[model samples]
Structures are given as structure tokens and as C-alpha cells.
Target: MKVADNLAQIQENIRQSCSNVGRSETDINIIGVTKYVTINRAKEALGAGVKNLGENRMEGFLKKYDEIGNDATWHFIGSLQSRKVKEIIANVDYIHSLDRKSLAKEINKRADRPISCFVQVNVSGEESKHGLSKEEVPSFIEKMANYPNVKVVGLMTMAPFLDDEAILRGIFRELRQLRDQIQAENWDYAPCDYLSMGMSNDYQIAVEEGATHIRIGSELVGPYDE
Candidate 1:
């Protein structure tokens, strides 16, 4: 299908969901995830009016980044390693998967420019994933305060996918809580102002639960890989 058609559909869905829950569609940001799609497809999405694009892998995004030129702001939304940080640094506008103190420190050290970043909170406690536990957020953020180069923009989480809204809500809720807590503690939270959650299937619900930035993957690009 056409990108405009898909965008319209998703916007309509957002409007419908917001109307039901007494929220405004304008309040939420739906990032067009480009990890599964090609740069050509991403160009189509940009033409279709998408200003933000999200990618997961470093090298893949680097390839597409070189070809796409510069226009849409890119967000790095997958698990990141300290080793792979340099390649993705200048290429990304925001790093969404900064999961540990060491990783954050590493990002801080080599970062030439101030990078917008989110602390990945492992709200689901799944071993298969990488993120700081909700309990560890305070200390993590404290450690991050020492990093002048990388600015904390907010928190990100990927709830374990299943047929359970409660599970999703529980995780997203934790992210929201952490975001609020951090903000309350320091208004200078700089780059940290977003709560990135949700995907194609569960985005509406995520918005209702207070998601400022929703990482929509299949919803925008249609299905996903990894």
C-alpha cells in the first residue's frame, strides 16, 4: 500500500482511539520505523509527511543513511553495544536503547556532540532483552548525570508481546512513572521529555496510557524483521 494511505489509516486510528479515551491525537508522536523497510521506502514515507524515522541496527542504518541524505530526524531504537557506539553516533539523532551505566558512560566519553538519549528500562524483566530494571533507574540516571556529552531525553521500553494489555500497561506504566519521577526531580532533564513505547498493534493503548513517543514498526512499514 501507499505510505500516505497507511499514514492516513494510522492517523484515523489514532484519532478514533483518542476520541474514545478523551485524549488528543496531536499529543502523541508516531515515529515511522524504517528498520524493516528500505531507504527508498523511507523516502516515500518522508514524501508522505513523516518527519521522524526509527532504525534498529547500526550498519544497516548507516548504509541507508548515506543513501537517503539528510532530512528526517533518525532515532536508533534497538539494543546497542558499547563497541558499536561510534558507527551509530553521528548517524543517529536519538539513541533509544542506552540500557546500562557503562553503556551510558561509554556514550558520554566518545560523544563529540550532545546526543539525545533514553534509558532503556527493562520493565518486563525478560532475560532475552537488555535494559535497566525500574529499580535501577535512579542510580542509573544518577550515574548518567556525570555524562556531559550525552543528554538523557527520556525512557524507553519494549513490553513482552502477548495477548495481554495488562502486561503491556504494566510495563509502559513503569516507564511513565520513571519519566515523571525523573522530571520531577530535575526540570533540567534536558533531552529527556519523551516516553517511547508501543508498536503497530498496541500503540493506541500505549497512547492512552501516556506515551509521548510511540515507536511504531509494523504499523508504518508493515510487518518487521527481528
Candidate 2:
């Protein structure tokens, strides 16, 4: 299928997902992850009406940022290295893998303006996942209060690839619950209003469970022609 058609299908699903739960489709942002596609293909997603684009690597983001222009919002959705924060700090609009204070300090020092960030939590306690333990999130957010340049906009988590729908749903639910718990704190800096859960396989479930942002890659942009 064409990238445009793929995008249309995803959008329709997003609308239906929102309708099923009485949430407005506009409440959710579709981040067409372009980490695996060429810049030309990334532009195809933009032409198809994807306003948000996500890249997992600094080099890929920089290359695409230069080639794709500034018409779209850029999201850095990978585990960002603190040393490379300066490389992407000024370019990307959102960083979805903030799980530590050192990274936050770097972003605070490098970002010219406040940058939206999602505190990544390892909800499932998977050793391979690069996120702070769920137990550490509250203190983590509290410490973030000192980083004026980092806005605690949401929470993000990666569910292990599995076929069981119930498990995936639970993982998303955990992230949403964490977001709600944090948002309830009413911290001045941690306005934790969004849940950046879901990816290509489970975004619809994520939306139904109160996800404000979904990062979709192959489902929206597909692989590069190479």
C-alpha cells in the first residue's frame, strides 16, 4: 500500500479508537516515525498530513531535519545519549526517552527554550528497557522541577513485543496510570498531561487507554527502498 493510504488507515483507526472511548481525535498526535525511511519518504508522510515526525537516532534526525525542512514537529524517540544532547537539543521539539537527571541537566543547559520531554518508565521491569524504574518516577519528576528548560509533558514506555493483547493493553494502562498519578501531583514544572505510549502494533489500544501521543513507524512510513 502507498504511504498516503497507510496514513489514512492509521488516522481512521485513531478516530475510531478515540470515538470508542469518547475522546476527540484531535486530542491524539500521530508521530509518523521516520527512523527507517528515507527523507523523501518522510516528506511523503508530511504530504499525507502527518504533522509530527519521530527519529530514533541523532544522525538520522539531523539528516532528515535538514532535508525535510521545518514544516513538521520533530520527536526524538530513542534513548538519547547525554553527550549528544547538544547535537539534537536545538533541533527536536520533543524527547521521549528522558529517564535520568544527567540527561535532564544536559537538556537544561543546551536547550535555548524549554523542551517537552516524556519521562520514560520501565513499567514492565524489563531489564533490556532503558527507563527509570516505576518506583523512581515520582522523585525523578520532583528533581526535574529544577530544570527550567525541560517541560515534563508526559510519560513514555516500551512494551515488550508480544502476541497477547491483554499484556500489551496492561503495559499501556500502566503508563497511563503513571501519567495520571504524576499529573495529579499538580507540580508546577511537571504538568504531566500526556501519555506517549503505543507504537505501530498497539497504538489503537494505547489511544483507548488515554494515550495523547502515538509513535508509528512501518505502519505509516514503511521501510526505505534501499
Candidate 3:
């Protein structure tokens, strides 16, 4: 039950998934979602060779960042409040929830350098999910050019947890098409080259559909009691 064992399996899954789609396994960056686990467990993920780590909350991110420092590439993989941007802007390498202009303004104002961001899209149309609708994304990304310190590196989405593989694949494919459309624009501020989709339940399908970054939580790092 060591993290390394779990990681190996995940890696293999990624490898197989990539092969299915003619993608190189090296293209996939597995982000160990450590928000649900302790810092010690996060470190175990690092020790297991998980170079990227994701945390959802500011407090959790800061706590792990305090101990782990630059040893791991930090990803803030949750909805970020504009008020909390200053606290995490400098420490985080990637933000996977850049959905609105207000949050974008805060990140641009606070970041010393251009921060990598993935525009979150609510592809599933679920009212509970936080992201811009597909129709809103193009205009939203076009405006990102004004925020000099925020770089739109990719798009992020969360598919509904369901047993249907077809539904999961469709959601991921739509996001991938959206990413391609944005990438083709060649916007200097929004290269939009990556796809930050998938989680513990649907990463395999996400990869097959061209996910460059996958966030794994309970699978990569087991959930811990709060």
C-alpha cells in the first residue's frame, strides 16, 4: 500500500492510455492531488517520484508549500477566491481554475511574473460545477491578453462522476477540441496548449482524449481524515 506502488500502476495506466491515442507517455504530467492527504503523505508522493502536486485550498497549499518548498511543482487545482490570490500567486506554478475576469485581474496584479493558468470550462453543464460555459470561454480567453501576468496555458474541466465511459469520453473530447481551437489562434498571452482535465475516476479516458495534465487525488494519494 505504498505510494510508489500506486504510482507505478497509475503510470502504467497513463502509458497504456497514451499508446491508445498514439501519444507519448512523456506528454502526460500527473499531478498528485494532495488536498485530501496530510503533508507527510504528500511528501510520500514526492518520494515516490510524483514531481507535480496539487492542493485545492489556500491553507492546505500553504501548509504543504511551507514544508515541501520548491521540491515539488505546485498546482492550485480548485476554485480560487480573488482575495486569496495574493497569498498563493508567488508560490503556485499552475492555477487550474481561472474562470472569471475578476480572479484573472487579481492574479495579474499580484503575480510578479506571468503565471500559468488553465481556464476552467463547465463542459458538463452541471449547475454545481464552477467554470465558464463553452460559449463564454472564447471571449473570456480573448480578454486574457489584457492581464499581462496571467498566461492561459490550457483549459480545465471536471466531468460528472458516472459509470458511462461514452459520456466521460465525450466531455473530455469537447474540452480537447476547445483547446485545439484556442491553440490555433496563436494568442501570445493565451497559448492554450494543454488540457487539464480528468481525476481519479476518469483519467484514463481523459488521457486518451488528449489530456496533458491529469489531477489524481484519492487514487494517487489516499484520502485522509480532516
Candidate 4:
């Protein structure tokens, strides 16, 4: 199926999800995860009205950014290495994996402007995930004040890939609550207004629980083809 068609379906699902929780679908930003597809397919996503595109790897992100330019809002949605920050910092509009002090320091040093970042949290306690543990998020965010160039716009997490809807909703809900707790503080550097949880497999659940940004990959742009 075409990207447009897939997008329309996803939009409808988002509408329903929002309606279920008395929230507005307009608040949800759909990030077309284009890391796996070709640049042309990424363009196809842009043609379909997906203005935000997400890439997990620096090389892939640089490639897509070269072709797409400012045509789309770019999101770096994977673990970022401190050394690679200088290479991609200027080009990316949002960094979704701001998990460590070293990476944050690099972004602060490399970026010419304050960067919008989501402090990645390993809410599910999965050893494989790259994020701060839930207990460590607050202090970590607090320390972020020193990194003047990085702004904590939200919190991000990847739930365990499972069929249990209850567990999925729990993880998403926790992230929302955590975001709210932080947002309430009204830190100039960490407003923490967005919840960057959810993905192709469980975005509807994420939406119902208060996800402002959902990263859809295979369901929206298809699986890895490179």
C-alpha cells in the first residue's frame, strides 16, 4: 500500500484513540520512522503529509537530511554517541535519546542553538534499552540545567514488545505521569510537556494514556528494505 493510504488509516486510528480519552488528535505528532526505507520512500512520506521524520542512525539520518533538507522536521530517535553529536547536531531538529550526561554535554557543546530533547527513560527496566532508569530521571534532568544548549521538551521510552495491552498501557501511563510530574515544576530548561512513547505496535494504547509524540515505523513506512 502507499504511504498516503497507510497514513490515512493511522490518522483515523489516532482520531479514535484521542476521542476515547477526551484528548485532541491534533496534539499527537506522527513521526515517520524512515531509517529502514530508501530516500525516495522517505520523500514519499513527505509527499503524504508526514512533516516529521525520525532516523535512528547517524549515517542514515545524514543521508536523508541531505536529500530532504528542511522539507521535514528531523528526529534522532536512537542512542546517540557523544562523538557523533557534532556531525548531526545542527541538522536535527529534535533529539529523542538524550539519556546520558556525556551525550548531553556533547550536544550542548556542538549545537549552535538550544536543542529540543526528550530524556529517554528505561521505564520497563529492560537491560537492553538505552535510557536512564525511572528513579534516575529527576536528578538527571536536574543536572541538565548545566547543559544550556539542551532543552528537555519531553520524556521517551520503549515498552517491552509484548502482546499484553495492560502492560503496554502501564508503561505509557507511567511515562505520562512522569512527564506531568516534571512539567509541573516548570523548569525553564525542562518543561517536559511531551510524552514521546508509543510506536507502530502499540500507539493507540500510548495515545489513550497521553502520548504527544508517537514514532511509527513499519506500520506507516513499512519495514527495513535496505
CA lDDT for candidate 1: 0.82
Candidate 1, superposed: residue stretches over 4 Å from native: 187-191, 224-226
Tens-place lDDT per residue, model 3, 35-74, is 8788889999999999999999999999999999999999
lDDT of 4: 0.94
Ranking by TM-score: 4, 3, 2, 1
Give candidate 2's total backbone clashes: 0
lDDT of 2 by residue, 61-176 (tens): 99999987689999999999999998988889999999999999999999999999999999889998999988899999999989999999999998888778899889899888
List the RMSD of every prediction in angstroms.
Answer: 2.2, 1.1, 1.2, 1.0
Q: After superposition, how far is residue 70 of candidate 3 from its true place, in Å?
A: 0.4
Q: For candidate 1, list the clashing residue pairs, or say none.
A: 153-191, 153-192
Regarding lDDT, does 1 or 2 come out ahead? Answer: 2
**lDDT of residue 120 for candidate 3:** 99
lDDT scores of the candidates, listed in order: 0.82, 0.91, 0.94, 0.94
Pull out the clashing pairs in model 2: none
Residue pairs with backbone overlap in model 4: none
- Name the 10 consecutive residues with the lowest summed lDDT in model 4: 217-226
Measured on C-alpha atoms, candidate 2 has an lDDT of 0.91
Cα distance off (Å), candidate 1, residue 204: 0.7
